[model samples]
Target: MLEKLLPIQKNLNEQPQNPDSSPEESNTSPNLLESFKDDFFESYSFVNKATLILKLFILILPGVFFFMLALNDALDRKIMALEDDKNVLTDELFVYPDVQAIHTSVVLREQILKQVNEKEHYAPAMLDSIIKSLPEGVSIKNEMVQGKTASLILLSPGPLNVASFITNVLKDDFAQEVSILSANLVMTQNIYEIELVVRYR
Candidate 1:
């Protein structure tokens, strides 16, 4: 029985194996191995990309933070400097009333000088008018000006001439007030001497 079983086993083992099955199994094993290798490489590449991104973030994050910190520091310093300047200016303004007073005085002086110049410009024209208004028998002996006031000593042939001079002076637009301070009849020269004071508006 053993001998008969051995022959049967030999025959079964010797029977022609399926030639296509070996090649197909061999091809499938290699394909599966190649697919596994490709999958492993793909996973490694993804992990490498993730690691590279993490490294880049780690590298750049501190630089960005430090840059922001430096910018903030610079702004703070600039703000502090501006505040210091403002404080200094405020302190100077607080400490110096004299400077303000001097500026005010200068402005006032300029205004006064401008007014004086304007008044002086009209003086010659006013003098011409006064001279033209005088009567033929009257002449100005002496004239003095102090600020807006005028003092005139007039020599007139008669009281009428003196009165005419006063009337003419009073009629002037620039004259605020006019007064004959004194009128004296001079017998030696047969003339009337009049002292007139005129005030300008």
Candidate 2:
């Protein structure tokens, strides 16, 4: 309620001032240094977990790597041993003198069969047909079978007998082809000698 009067005060302009900093910034200076120290020195929780994971990987990696290598080496040796045993067994089988020859013969037979594609086996029916077709005066002298073909030497009283036999043989279903290889007259025996080939279907 008194009348306004001028108050005595110090001259603040005479003192040096920091134009860049406020009172609020001056109060936070010490706290900034403390925060910097914490950031530099402290470990974060995520960083600790990552470091643990890295350590586990380092400890386990070499053991797993070496174990895999050893397992592979053992498998290789086992395979080699099996191969050696197989070779030895194969060789031992051939110790019987005829085994190798038999094997070779079988292999050759298979190759021949595959190439020839011959499917028929001469049965009793074939023998019956041949015997039935032969005339009474005609006789089969020598007979040999090779694959799908048969060769025979015959003694016939006359050429007519041979022709009749050939005609009868060709009438049978079991014969696919027929050929006469030779014909000769035997003066001493008074018989005609004939060679014949028959191919079966």
Candidate 3:
């Protein structure tokens, strides 16, 4: 066996050692540029992804703060405007011309008071005297007595008798004076109606 292996060993020793064939020698040599290309690409891809993330974070920061400030300012302005509008409306409510509830109440009270006062304006004794003095065939249409004078309208049959009666009444001591204010002659069914005004005590 030893004698048979000697020839193979001698042949192995005769083979030449190529310097570029070793793995360590190939790594140390800088001429093989394709070997490191995958590592460079992986490192560049990682760095690009990181840079993109950082830029996105920086861009979003100011936008978030600016939005918050804008919302706050809008709310402040809205609140101030509402307050001013409320104040203006409150002030205007007082001076508005159509708000007449108080004035209407006062006017109603005045009208009622005036009606009540007018009902009680006459003296009782004077009213009694005028009612007692109404004569037959000489009906008074209206009478307004004040102080010592009594003004009245007398209805008579004719103008001649009314004139004579007026003259006679004026001569009496109780009569003060006589002056006719209005006269109207109405004729119907053979009857003459005369309206005359007379002044008396």
State which candidate has the highest TM-score.
2
Candidates 1 and 2: which is better by lDDT? 2
Q: Give per-model TM-scores.
A: 0.43, 0.46, 0.29
**Which parts of model 3 have CA positions greater than 4 angstroms off?**
1-42, 96-201
User: CA lDDT of each candidate?
Assistant: 0.80, 0.81, 0.64
TM-score of 2: 0.46
Residue 149 alpha-carbon offset, candidate 1, angstroms: 1.7
Sort every candidate by TM-score, greatest first: 2, 1, 3
Instruction: Give the per-residue lDDT digits (tens) of candidate 1, residues 39-136.
Output: 65469788898899999999999999999999999999999999999999989888886988899999999999999777555566567657877988
For residues 12-129, write the lDDT of model 3, one tens digit per residue.
5544355455564335334677456666547978889888998999999999999999999999999999999999998998796665887898999999999988763434544554
- Pick by lDDT: 2 or 3, better one: 2
Best by lDDT: 2
lDDT of 1 at 8: 60
Q: Model 2: how large is the Cα RMSD against the reference?
A: 10.9
